[model samples]
Target: MPPAHSTRPAIAFAVAAFGIGTFSLMDAAMKDLALAIGAYNAVLWRNGLGSLLTGVLFLGTRQRIPMLAVLKLHLWRSFIVALMAVSFFWSLTVLPLAEAIGLSFIAPVIALYLAAVLLGETIGREAIIASIAGLGGVAIILVGKFSGDYSDESLWGAAAVLFSAVVFAYNLILARQQAQQAGPIEIAFFQNLFTAAILALAAPWFFSMDATGEIPMIAAAAGLAIISLLLLSWAYARAEAQVLIPVEYTAFVWAALCGWAFFDEPVTLTTMAGTALIVGGSLVAARAKPKLVEHTEITTA
Candidate 1:
């Protein structure tokens, strides 16, 4: 039987999978709503309502909202998150949602490398091999796009998604560090607050009230947004890089399904091949034995 603490990482992995799937589905739903309404409006409403809900919930819970010192980190992280959202949403407009989402899984690869370089954890041979395989998978997918079904902007879209992935990996590191010093609520609360502030400036020019004549759609987006964030926060606070990274790739599964079902974009052989490599490589990384000891001594008298 595996040690008890071993289960903790496994539990975190489950939570991260939920986070990935829920967020992907939520994003797809938001994109559909945005198309009916408008992108800027969807973004504005989601951010505004999400920030409001977060603030209200935080106040109810009485978490010590991080002071200015921590707020600086919050702002920096929020900036990254804002950029990521813009890039991701824009990419979804140009690229097949599944392909764009597949590329975004590169964030986990970035996170693994960052964990080694920035956090000073040793990069194991398996991780290096997995990274190479994952990159090869991405190349295969991109090469297939040369058949001309995709647009010239698809390349830029892919690049944007990849950049977002990189920035978001750094965000994960910052969130993990903050989680150690404070509760997930504090980190989440300030994240939404600062993200709201950054996004609010953009709203004046971009915001709109036209959303398919559906207030319910806006409310649905808000609910999913909150669910996504809560799951992400809960998972990030608990999981190790290896476990979390693998699970994050599952987001593409949600995207692929959503895209196919809603947009009628047929899944191709190339997608499957690339997805196999990416998922396989991520699994290899996740399956690597965690070096940290899993069991602690009990104070037996």
Candidate 2:
């Protein structure tokens, strides 16, 4: 029989899956906008709009921003998140949709291992085997592309995607800790404010001449990104690592569909193979039960 606390993480995984799906759609919209306005410009506008929305919500809900201590964490978190967004979007422009999505799937596995390292959680036999199997699957899927015209440029893009995954894993660990202490709304508000500030500083360096036609799409993307981040943060705060990590893979299905519908990216056997391994690993991890520990504690960073 499953433990009583297991259900909460299961519920959180479900929510995270939905949020990832929504984010895929949002990425599709942003991709189109980026094509018109450039990736940097799109990011700038989206972050700015998202920050404004967060500001309004904070004011309306009567939530107060914390002292400099909390503000410092928010700033660092925002910088990393912004870097993540830029890198991921830049990769979107180069790699084939399926390849990009496949590589992005590496993050959850990274997070699973990191949980063991940073949070002192155990990586059981099942998870280790699952991780190796998942890596094998990814290698098999990319076997053909090894000799193709995949120049150093594409290689860098792949590296960027991997690096982004690492930062994202770190970001999640921090955000999850923060969420445990504060309400989701408080976390969301500070994240937006911090992201906005960082992007605003970056705007002059990255801004372009195409903002006029791209504002609407940027606005749409901002809304989706904000909502997705909030949902994911809230869900992670309530959930355990083993369960929630697997569900994040649902982003690929969403990415594949969105890539096909918007970017005309085709599905192939490799994608199916990689996706299968990912799902299998997730299922194995989800089913395993780790010994219960003290409840997670959250504090203002």
Candidate 3:
């Protein structure tokens, strides 16, 4: 059997943080693409390139065909995640990257309650507290952001992100099942391929020729996404969930830096305070989750 837990928590933590960094960087790339050609078009193109990239890596491994149930789970997740990514990427077009990510911290907490309802898991105290704190964070963010003079687009962007987070929380449930049945490359491979297929159905209405000019950026985003996935998967496989989950919060830092450097967006004090409650709540939920659930988050942002 593979090494089930990391021998060094410190190194594993760093690796996990690096993984989040790559993922955040990829998000910044996607934001640029979204700004150029719309989020739907940008994500659609990224998935197409991602499918080709991951397909090559997956085929190289020469793995056997997955079971039918695994394939079904993969397809289902692709559909859900397609919705999630498009909406969230659209949010990035209007919201500050750090603020958007801070709002997304609620996804895992939402997943906790979802597990309780769908999987029949008991609603423990930590899970309850996590939900409350996560909502509190969201409240702080909405109140702060909305209090400012802003366009309707920004308002819609925040709503879009929360909607995406709901879909993402459900995706987390499916991710746990899929993780039990597939490796990271296989999961990435099918998600990219099938999500593109699912979204391609809308090509007639939403597709843009402008996307052709953005191929290089889209390909770079896909490459960064795969690297992030591999790093997170490797670290998660070797470390306890509680050990690595906190590193997910590092996305805020990366998002902040990327937002500042790339887009000149400022991170506000309200975003920081709200992120604290959200991350604090998620930490509680992570501690309460069964060790087996470590793999569940491997597929997420």
Clashing pairs in 3: 6-238
Clashing pairs in 1: none
Candidate 3 Cα misplacement greater than 4 A, ranges: 1-17, 120-142, 232-249, 275-301
- List, residue by residue over 1-301, the lDDT tens digit for candidate 2: 1122323455566788788887887888777776677667777778778878877877888765565665677778888888888888777777766577678767767887788777676767766766766666666666743446777889998998898888888876676556555556666777777776777776667777668777778788888987887888767766656556666665666777788887788767776777687667656756656543222323333
For candidate 2, give the lDDT. 0.71
lDDT of 1 by residue, 134-208 (tens): 777766766774466656787787788888888878876775555434455565666767777787797768766
Q: Taking the tens digit of each residue's C-alpha lDDT, what string does model 3 give over 142-245?
A: 57766758788988998999999889778866764565557778888998999999999999999998889988899999999889877765665544443454
RMSD of 1: 5.4
lDDT accuracy of residue 119 in candidate 2: 69
Best-to-worst order by lDDT is 3, 2, 1
Ranking by TM-score: 2, 1, 3
In terms of lDDT, model 1 sits at 0.68
User: Which ranges in model 2 have alpha carbons more than 4 Å from their true place?
Assistant: 1-7, 144-147, 290-301
> Please, what is the whole-model Cα lDDT of each candidate in the order they appear?
0.68, 0.71, 0.77
What residue pairs clash in candidate 2, if any at all? Answer: none
Best by TM-score: 2
